[model samples]
Target: MEDPKRLEEGLGHENKDRNEQFSEKDDKTKGGDGINHEKEETNTVVVVEQKGDHKQLQQQPLVKQKTKRVATLDAFRGLTVALMILVDNAGEAYPRIDHSPWNGCTLADFVMPFFLFIVGVAIALAFKRIPKKRDAVKKIIIRTLKLLFWGILLQGGYSHAPGDLSYGVNMKFIRWCGILQRIALVYMFVALIETLIIKQRQSVVEPNHFTVFTAYQWQWIGGFVAFLIYMITTYALYVPDWSFDVYSHHKLERYMVKCGMRGHLGPACNAVGYVDREVWGINHLYQSPVWSRLKACTLSSPGSGPLREDAPSWCRAPFEPEGLLSTISAILSGTIGVHYGHVLIHFKDHSERLKQWVSMGFGLLIIAIILHFTDAIPINKQLYSFSYVCFTAGAAGIVFSGFYLLIDVWGLRTPFLFLEWIGMNAMLVYVMAAQGIFEGFINGWYYKSPDNTLVYWIQEHVFIKVWHSERLGTLLYVIFAQITFWAVVAGILHRLGIYWKL
Candidate 1:
């Protein structure tokens, strides 16, 4: 049998030789492992084989370097980010493009989780390059802190407006947690376990003696344990202080109602607040008075209610998707992503098997069925319910696999370049959007002409007048607006080569 190491070394040498030839001449080469060159000096072409020990070549840095990023994965990530921006900025004109209120899924619901899954995939690729366990843990912690800080900043930090600090907290007041913050926390914990625990165990277990069940078996068990703990901690077991008193015959609902007179009714109803405050306490929920005061200053306005309302009714509360408990499930979703990344790495070129796709398809089917039938695990973003996590994960897996197949396997590329460009600079675009750089200009249209705001003009003229279909027209309008914004962003980033990294 031919040695795999020797073959890899020989391939690297051939690549190096080709590069050397190309540098020597001002021309380019084409084709596979063998090099065919055409010289600009003469219209002649030449083929050459440089003989050397492929084993020695294998030890070179080029041969031993990690795999190049698969473009399909980046494209998939870009598509996910684009969807996030569109859904986030749908401007109330297109309800269907928005996420489901509670206990349901929508096209918009899949975006954030897909980004999280991609984060897991990126983490898997990253850890391979950082060999030291302690060093990896330190790096993960630093990254997590940075993400948490940024999440808080985006949540409110640096003031909702410039030169405004009269609010309770510096800008981090509404510093409850967020999408990137959740991702950071999950990545930190997962990296710690994978490095300190899983890798250590694997090292002790000899490769030849290992079965899949024995070697990588801990991760599945760990996932289930985490899920079980989260469910029990969040739902099945409740703190006595927050529960109805059987002896006193006072229902919890009645208690909340009695307390409603203290400005606790309607939007101020503290049923959800009581649970988050009394049950989980401030540690997990992190609801400081300063944060509440900051929220009152920054988010108490008319149009911001829907987006800023954290604690609704108790029934609706846990389903907030971004709530404290739901984050546990989201962390588990990240674990699921990590496991999928492992499969991608270990299987590599063999991922095209019929069984693999079939298994993934079945996983998605099961999630869909559960999402349709089960009411206990609501598909609410606030609660981040187990069902919601499963549903989003399944959808994300399907999308990732599809992208991998199309871009990596089939070598197809096309109109997605704009998306790819923005994706490479996603954080920058998000921050820029948040800072009102584009919103300022977009909203400026409304200032000039009362009916000329982009959304208003589209609703009145494009949807109502030009097109008959309100929903479809409005949806298209949103897409057009998003694409226009993306084009501007892409042009700027392309010009400066300014890709933001965290």
Candidate 2:
């Protein structure tokens, strides 16, 4: 009987020897003691063989036909969604959890990019299991539209109807750009690229379950081209001289006359903002985009539409950070994720896979740092700046790599079940939380009166009293309640055997 170690050997070498080593009968039957695992949960699978009466283990594929998800990706996604809920809820309590006022990355800023990256990785994995479905394009288009519809319906920053069940859907002043809208558009674009242009390089006849798309030369070509497109478009388009003076129209005109940037091609005067304003109209843009306010003008509150036309000159009109043009960069973030996905599924050696992630992750990070310091590109989330995506994607790569090493390589799954539960039903939680389902359904009871709100009451009595600070208590409660509440809900959902997608 062959040693079991052969079953766990590198797929590349073992597969190479299969034709000469095994007879035709070897391929025909499973025989005894040679059952193969269908789950591609780890980097390797143990294949077994039979010779005469002696059943023996032999080389196996790293992944099987089904390609069940690697637990690490689920953990990564869960952690990302969990943090998103935390920061979104914490905005009122902790200033640090809030997004940077204008041009820098924050813990909050990292969430969107990482999620986009996860989408890319998931795309690679999903396609491997079921490529070229009869309704593939139809499914892609439908999914894309659903995401877009939900984005506009729930997060479009439209006002509600007065004393009516129907939403206002106010066309006169509805914001077109939003978190989910950006996600939908990005996903559609990437999926189209995968389905039509990139073209999967797989071996259909051989039927090696472990084999995934190499993408090879095309991967680098796609990435480089995406970068070029973003950089050129970011800089080449013309933008008007922005007015900083909110009140004195005459002063603004005068300042525009002499300001060096007025006629210059600056980022503040780029094509992205100009096009968005024209298409969506200033009144239809995000009201609370991270922008500078001056001359006693206050920032617009969340969910508000664009500034009034009559607003003082100092009140900056909203410009979407996730605007149309920056979406190209967003797609690039997903592209990088696809590359990592290739490494994960195609590369069988754990060390080789780790090396690839480290190189890709650090390479992007270093390039981002260089571009930022050299002013080749700025790290601005508002613009979805080129450098910003590079940095975020880099961090995401390193993070997932670490999780894969721990959970998949070291076989540590039980420790992260809490995160796994949340991850499996991430989209459900996100949409529900975004639409005020949590607050409307659950918090309504808690906040009916001062006595009923357990979280606030506890904070007021315990954390505040012990810490001797109201703000500190509120911050602590914000972190604790969000994580705990969601984890419990996710746990129950997991136990109920429900998985939500799209």
Candidate 3:
């Protein structure tokens, strides 16, 4: 018998306990044979042996079991996490690698949604084959709390610096919600959807496609429902008295106007900002938002105002991009990942799988285009607009399809093993990144003046001097060097089997 409590390394339906069934069968046999029942329950495995003249019974301790893992899924998750580390580190130097300052999507804009999408995929991979609904719910609640706990305490959130904290500690500027917190939330809610609302079917050799819809159909239904709810909440449920026109910025005033959300409607007055402000309190939100930084929208021109005295020169307003309301659409992005996971599981034909991937990607992409062109929904990452959901989810589907084609279907996994290493220990690296432990380690190797570290010297001599622009060269060096640095770190951890998951 295998131990029931086993460590899961990678994603899949939490390995079904092979020993549970064996134990149950042995118990029934023991009960019929009039063997002691209480003894069987504790660290005991029954064994019957036959000698030349007599038969004997023996018991042994339970052993461990191995569960199935998906390598491609690991690749997907690793690729996303690695990129997150890359862009986050580089964004400090290169503005281009960072999120789009405002409404439009940039390379960095795709990272978060893609990460969410992978989470969705992970949920399906982890629980699709699970039959115990109660168990699924339990796992969801527990992991949600763990992630949320760390998210609140990590960097870019609470003021944990030794200098900032003294006496009672200054808690006024602490952030209430963040990236990990949002991932936890989306995972919990979406897991509930798959576990409770959409009941899992029994294992099957061939899962029948939604008979009516040739495609998996769950993807379509989930996407449409998520978007419908998001659209209605964002547009129809508008707060009033706050107009759409460009206005002013105040440290206290997140939205453009001084009237506040007595009642406001429009892009600026979306529920995403309102809920975060009311629920988390303005002080707890990110002091400077990604969108407001480098771009200014004010009373006169679109983003055409001087840096408000209340705010920093880069950004004065405290608007949480990963707000409570935005989580609504983020779930949709994750739903796309869940759909892809199902496609991987149920479909065997590589060509058919490829076709489905293409179909799903294009379908969503076209819809997003229509929404953007019609002006019915703009692709605003700040708001997590319906168009943005569609666009990003579509992009995620397409990117995953590429991985499916090159890695899973083709089985060219050797090159992607680097990413797999990172993927396997995604949470560990994520926490380290959030804590800035990676930066501290990098600094520890230097023994020169504060500004004359190995990285700085390389940037100065090899990058900035060789390249034309100081900022551009520095940016390029960070982008390349940081990703390589993190990849090596992730690789080392993976080699040591140090995969940390909740």
Candidate 4:
């Protein structure tokens, strides 16, 4: 409840006023007309109102307590942010946890889907009761724009990475798509869909098995339509030979990749890559792709290394992982999340919620397994295939339910308090830690040389030197230095009631 509360409280600047208005409405509608207000039981308390010996027993509706924020949702979201920091920071030294080279699931590959899934779940709670549709639409648009602006600002190939002490991006080659950008697109469409279609909160004493499904049938249909479009475009599009130009030793060089193929899902020739190139342009796409680490491209196989002698021309070409088609497919994750949020809104009983969540979770997993094993979809994160959505969304549901069980149901919130803190202000942590804004700022302060910053010294002397293992040291640095430090910052912010929403 705390998790959804944080979102409802922080997501929009106007939510506070909106909540107050709802409270006022509740107060005014406390008589015969308001008897069936939003799932309220018919229990009433006697009020004594007397006027000169005429004793009258007036019954007042028992006001329901405000819904507390879901600690489980906060903890679960915080866990996702933590995993993002871990994988992004430590994956370079540990390839096992890194994103899959091409068409498999890895720890790192789950991060994006997990993020999308969280957004989906949050949308359900955020739009539980939309008092003013126009205002809600305006807020959604503003937030979506903010996400887009930040995504482009932070990840638009402008800001230098940790090691580089440089600023500014080459506008000509600035990447237009990234992790946040994809999230922005998904959030915009999903939030709009929910805002446009959601009915007013209705009282349901005992919602049948298909109540949630029936309520959100349009969202499901939209998801299916999007999925169908993705499938058709993926399988029917004719991909021809594509070429990209790059400067090699200050000389302009062009490389042509012969990919006159259709329905191919390899790293070289895929409909996703083709669509991105045709739409966003090759220069605007991500320069360094995970495909470069593929066995066919690199001699080192899993880790990025020198290109193999027989590497294909497409290996060097730019590819955007969070491309247009893949992002369209990603909307399904958010749709599934909305369904979970609906369950939370409708069902107050822990057992019933868990039953629905677990059932859906396992059901999605089963579909993912069937599609993957049958070689139909193959669970490709790069493509954001149908199977990938099912697998990741299912896992997200089960994991979220586990957190709900542990923290919300069982009242075990202490152990995961740090995660809850981070979840409460996830956007702040994401910008500071995951995006390396803090690192870049810290590196700005140096003694004599740019490389002599506190960040570099700590990574070299404190972590790597102590462990004598670069991989282990890198992992520990991320855990202790980045994750722990941000956790404390978020906790302080949470205590201070300071949150960076949007």
Query: Residue 250, candidate 3: how far off, in angstroms?
Result: 15
lDDT of 1 by residue, 1-502 (tens): 0000100101112243332211112122211101111222222334344577432222222321222234554566667767776776563455455665444666677877887777665554334333455665666677678778877665534334212212345432244566777777777766566656634344222322123225556655666777776666655432332322111245433222123222121213323344455544433343322112223323532122332455322321221235455565677676766656555534423343223533664686587567658655556554566777777877777777777666555656566556556556666655655333454445455646644576566556865567777656756665666555665676576567445656
Q: For residue 441, give model 4's deviation from the true position in Å.
A: 0.4
Residue 177 error for model 2, in Å? 1.4
Question: Best by lDDT, which number?
Answer: 4
Can you list the residue pairs that collide in candidate 4? 1-68, 1-69, 1-70, 1-71, 2-69, 2-70, 3-70
Superposition error at 342 for model 4 (Å): 0.6
The alpha-carbon RMSD values of the candidates against the true structure, listed in the order shown, are 11.2, 9.6, 9.0, 6.3
Error of 3 at 171 (Å): 1.9
lDDT of 4 by residue, 1-502 (tens): 0111112311111233322222212211111101111221234789898999897999888856443345666777788899999999999899989999887899998899888887778787667666678877887777777778889988997788676878899899998998888988898888888878857334352656678887677888888888998999999999998889978898999998888989998887889999999998889998888889998899897997999889988888888999999999999998998888778767756788899999999999999999999998899998999999999999999999999888766777799999988887888898899999999999989999998999989998999999999988999999999999999998987677666766
What is candidate 3's lDDT per residue for 1-502, written digit by digit as tens?
1111211122223332331111111121111001111112235688989998898988887653332345666677777776777667666566666776666677777878888888776665455444456775776788788778877777444434222221232476677778888888887777776676544343333544443133335555766777777667765564543312223563333344443352232335557777777788866777666655543433322222455445432244567888887887788887777777666545555676677777888898999899888877777787888778889889888888888777755667789977776676677666665345555445446565555566557777887898977877866665565555556787886566454556
Model 1, which residues run further than 4 Å from truth?
Answer: 1-68, 157-173, 201-214, 239-275, 279-320, 350-354, 371-376, 434-437, 441-474, 491-496
**Top TM-score hit:** 4
- Please rank every candidate by lDDT, starting with the best: 4, 3, 2, 1
Which residue pairs clash within candidate 3? 239-263, 239-264, 240-263, 240-264, 241-263, 296-303, 297-303, 311-316
* TM-score list, all predictions: 0.66, 0.74, 0.74, 0.89
lDDT of each: 0.50, 0.61, 0.62, 0.80
Give the per-residue Cα lDDT of candidate 3 at 429: 65
| Candidate 1 lDDT for residue 335 | 71
